[model samples]
Target chain A: MTESGHSSGGGMTARLVAAPRVRRGARQKVGDIVLSVVLIVLSLFMIVPLVWLITTSVTTRAEAFQLPPRWIPTPPTLANYAEINSLIPIGRMALNSLIVSVLATAGALLTSTLAAYAFSRIRFRGGNTLFSVLLAALMVPVQLTVIPLFILMRTLGLVDNLAAVWLPATVNVFGIFFLRQYFASIPRDLDEAARIDGAGHLRILFQIMLPLAMPALSALTIFLFEATWNNYFWPSIFLQSNEQMTLPVGLVQLQGAVGGGPAVVVFAAITAVVLPVLILFLIFQRSFVESIASTGLKA
Target chain B: MSSAPVAVSTVRRRGIEGRSNLAGWFFVSPAVLLFIVFIAGPFVAAMGLSLFSWDLLTPARFVGMENFTRLFGDATVWLSLRNTFVFAFASVVTHIVIGLALAVAVNRPLHKVVQYVTRSAIFFPFLISWAAVSLLWKYVLDPDFGIASYYLGRIGITPPNWLIDPQWALPALIGIDWWHTIGYTFVILLAGLQTVPGIYHEAAKIDGANAWQRFWHVTLPIMAPTLVFAMIITFIGAFQIFEPMRIITDGGPSDSTRSIVLYLYQQAFESFQVGYASTIALVVFAIVMIVTLLQLRLSRRWMGHD
Candidate 1:
């Protein structure tokens, strides 16, 4: 994968190789300048909405509604944040989201890694057929399964519970498929050596393969965490009560409850809902990009 | 003594192999169980439910093909389908064009800081949840004091009541969807661009191919598989777009912006037409499957991968 371009030397080598003909006279320079300017503008276009969201969240109600629109909050206040908390249990919703995302991530990682190991390493009966079935499930959108799953959950008396949100998500076929590919890339010699050393299958997986596949695991962890954290559709359906709702679901209820109220408060709630994930992305942007790239490119 | 020992070791090896097989099943049991209970079970149940007429409260009467037939005659179903197709089509074209262009621009050798910042800035919106994005756009497109209307009015072009106007609502939702998702398409294309082996471009240049020719002949062919992948996912996603419409407009302005999923939601929840909704779900499944297969089949012609 060209993800290997993470090295500075690779970039320099590419530049050095392309320097002569690509550095054609003033025309190329102008084109480069234009491309740079366009990219900068597009970048600003992307970032400005987020900037507006943060600014609006802090701005007073009067300032937020101003005709010209203030780019920055004058007399910025955390009052809206307080107001949002009062309107809905933002803290409680955040906690629910945190709990659900954490559990879902852990569950997905465990299931996917185990399944992937079985699929990749173990020569079990019907393994290919089972993997093919799992891959087929990948193409089936969750929305198509939502109605029956809802009924199933109802029958199981799991409605309005966090389990409804995380349970279905626990078996991520993409994660299984991804990790299987990663695990398959590891040489068979290690596992053979582990086996010769009297290491059991579980020991071989845990002690040898799992450690080598840490990058892939970390990537899957970030993907699963972000996906679960941001999931709104299933949570919206399953969690009806205010206390049970995740942040995304709660935000919608907040919008309804505070209809025609101060817009800043809503913005504050939006900011509150979005900030944690944004910070997570900023920290783990590389892994996020790498995982997405690997998935798309490999597929 | 050697034959006896060899036979004993062979038996032990067979025992170990059998144990490993059992271990494999044990390892995969949790995932398989969940897949059965959640995915495969629901899919089969949906098929069965679609064959019956039932609201949650009533005893379901078997109606065979009645729901499917009704779907054919249903005006709102057609309307929502049309809306979904329009949204999906527009999304695919715009995301591809804009994403590819952005990827090309960014693929140029730029300052490391500039590259990182640009990538992060563009991809940031994708990291945010659809709920947050939908609300943020709603605020931005608010008719009364929205910055969008404010800015447009300044330029002597009055923006329509975006979410309220039927004519504007779907377009507004499409624009919001683009804003939220273009980052994903961009990143994918950028990754594809990185894998395009600079030598191809250099080779093209040596053959006296101009920039446009090089891109058309070399860059595009290499990027075709990634492009198709992006397109298929974007279409699937766009067809299932419910969040923006649900949040921003509530599928309002006379249901002009209602996607098929939103319509299905309305049918199942609001109208309590679970059987009919299941039928719709099946339709969605079929459409996604057919479209995906069609794309896959057609892609072989243009895609370099055999």
Candidate 2:
């Protein structure tokens, strides 16, 4: 639990904490092979649902529901893709998701980065107490807040509007906590050196701290974006109509429709919702994994 | 020290402090504003609302403790609580068990590319939204025309109506949850496993300790903190289970799958009892806070003994 092996926000931390691999005996090699076989098969269990989703989305109805489901459609069609929007107006829902995720992530990052700087670098009265208050806010489940938040949203006339989804998201308590940890880990001399050169706190945070804190910042961005994109409950509650819903909410509505609104089309809708995240995962795989792995250190 | 210089330095320090005090509040004001408006305000509202009888359509009427008194006797509340506990217990046990196994299995002298591929494949499912995952599972568990059914049938075991049957619904949700979230726990455990110094295992091996003994003695102790952390997080997340129940079963098959949060939502939105729902929400906060505090205390005790 000590912060000796790896601190919070450094590029080389992962390398430093990684234990060197020891040479294995002949018996262990055989065990490794067996473990590999078992894990790869298990990994297939993890992936097959997604693969089936894409395959089902691309297939015709006949190919989709046939006994012993087809891995690939005989003539994979773009036909279901066309029908998804018509059936559920999923394209509009996706736009709503995109707007909410982007706005919220950007707002969270900006505000949290600023607050984190103040917390880590500046001396102020009641700073520790305020930090504790935010930490307390972090633990109360979002469900607990919804009863009142629903009222607030209604009072603001933001129900059925994307603004409601993204507004409260603008201030992420976890993001502040995370960025503060990362900011605190950096050596004070680096920012002090900037201060000696006549730079203010803003300049120091942007020029020195932020660039160095990119490792944690990007990780936080990925998570904030993912959380915003994937959220189902509040959006489902606040959003009244289909057009205002996020993609996940829309997908549920689609499923609840007649006969689950054609299996092929629903899968197509699901795929569209998952596509952005899947692409982000592929692109930022290392940072994403490292960020998640580093979360253990919080223990 | 000279008194003049000491006084000068004190003045300088006070000046700097004055400036930083302003700057600090300035930087953090946005966050403070948002927190008060969104989180703190809502929490206070929740407390006040819990004491009143209000539906969204009507002005709140003072009815202190009525909702709370009713909470103790509601059959659905107790049923959902039981189901949630069972689900959380199962989730925590399974996640830690499988997560540790997977991490230990992969902490080996595998090729770099092989390691990356294996890790990515297992972890990929964690990235997909729960909503998408829930919908995709319906297809996978479809009785007549699903791959699971097709495969299980071939093996001479019938796959039950997963999301429908009351007996199978909760278990099926647990299975799907494991598939979706175990990767996160696996990654945490994996990181913990990798941080264990190679020298300890080598020393254990030199003492003629077998793999199990080395793991049970050395690795398990080293990874205990990560295990505890993952267990608490997984349990908390599982306890708040909503998406799958809302989308998949709608808390059906005799209300067997209705989670506490889902039930709260039903009361608040469907039944339009905001006061009762706020009380339920308080119950959730209390339970989570109590459990988290209990976990921290127990972990402290256990770690102290260790």
Candidate 3:
């Protein structure tokens, strides 16, 4: 097959080569080298700003704006980190963010998984109708809903509480739809067999089905955690006191040089907030990427 | 075949139909209850408040359609709409082009490691919050002490004031947005690129096609559907841009960077014009719906890769 196909396309290769055949391999090699060099240089450029942020975070105030731009600090101290740590209660902000993110993830998992099971496994009146409405909700930008959500939260007296942020985010339309698709793709035979053995619907979902769907569940957990961790807008509006601020909002207030102190202090605050998210991504980076790709394909 | 056994099972299933009804509701009640309390409930309340003017401190008066009328006449609202469109358009275009180019360059069949590293590096920006991103750019764009200015001075060209200057502020915001958002589009597009079969390229080569021609005919058509999805998502994200503009510019330099969301926030929360803010939100909603519908419609014409 190779020989036949090569002979059939032999004339095409000749026409494509504007130069001698002996140089073709050499040209392709040169192309690879040049491409590699270009990619390396571009990647470095892209990374330089982030590296600068890390460096500046550790640098003292005086050295932060030093002439000729000190690529590395002379005596890299944790003073800036220490200063920011005390100046703004970074711990409190982190705690607020943690509580909100943790609860939101749990709430999302419980609600979305159940909805997914209902949409995928159960055949009931208005089931498809409900699922379609959920899909349409994905198109409605959350901004459009924020105004109304704020009013409702205020009426419920949930303002300034973590529940204000957690409750609303739990209603993620995309999360429900995502898990629904994943569940639908699971073999129905397992579910049917469980049913024949006198298992109830909830029992089937929690026992046999949930165990088998761990991959999708784990992926959804990571997605939910990251999204909730990084949320800024609602938290900003809902929580009033500095004591209740999430990391994103707290980081904003923590910024700006303090009493002629070094800019590194602000950088330290930024670094502290970013560290957990960076670590989270690194740990689950493969599953995170795979889940995102799978969702795209499923859509 | 197993027709008789299947029939027996069907008869058993019919007998259990009444029992299954309560189970379905039991299984779905938690999600349904949360959706009602959180989403459906809020949506109804928001609409109700939009019809009345109230600041939580004061009693609301029912003023039907008055808020929307005021919203339509507000010039700032109109300006914000224009800024939002320009912001979303410029950023989405640059993101798609840069993302596609990087994906193709790094996706060479021989260098899997290189592809993985480059993609991870690009995707790093996405993990960082926009609040941090705004801080990073603030220093980089600072006119007096920013590295950008110093580099320009070394090259004998005066640096443009990036953030403070009204004329450059929007472009500057766009640049920062692209730097942050290109990663998202890159990942989505790369996923799409991985699905395009290499067999098509070899066939095109056999048919005497040049490099550029092969990309145009084989790679692009196949990636069109993913591209549409990416662009629409990018458009939605761009339209809702708030944090970067709010944190970096604060709608400064004569409010040139005031986005629709920012404006709506000011109207609803800052000015305590709850009714007007809701009207503006409804307008924003209308625009999003129109754009999304247009995207869905247009995807039919050019987005097919099958």
Query: Which 10 successive residues of model 2 chain A have the least lDDT summed?
Result: A17-26
Model 3 misplaced regions, further than 4 Å: A1-22, A256-262, A296-299, B1-15, B110-113, B298-306
Q: Which pairs of residues clash in candidate 2, taking residues 3 or more apart in a chain or in different chains?
A: none
| Candidates ranked, most accurate by TM-score first | 2, 1, 3
Sliding window of 10 residues with minimal summed lDDT for model 1 chain A: A1-10
> lDDT of each structure?
0.85, 0.86, 0.78
For every prediction, compared with the true complex, DockQ reads: 0.59, 0.59, 0.52
lDDT per residue (tens digit) for residues A1-299 in model 1? 23333343557776565455444645677888787777788788788778888988898776776778678777888898889877788899999999999988899899999999999989877788999888777778777799988888888999999999988888888999999999999999999998898888789899999999998888788778878888888898899998999998888886663337677798899998888778877898888888777766554
Chain B vs. true chain B: TM-score for each candidate? 0.92, 0.94, 0.90
Predicted structure 3: lDDT: 0.78
Docking class of 2: medium
TM-score of chain A of each: 0.89, 0.88, 0.88
Task: Report the candidate with higher DockQ, 1 versus 3.
Answer: 1
- Interface Cα RMSD of candidate 3: 1.9
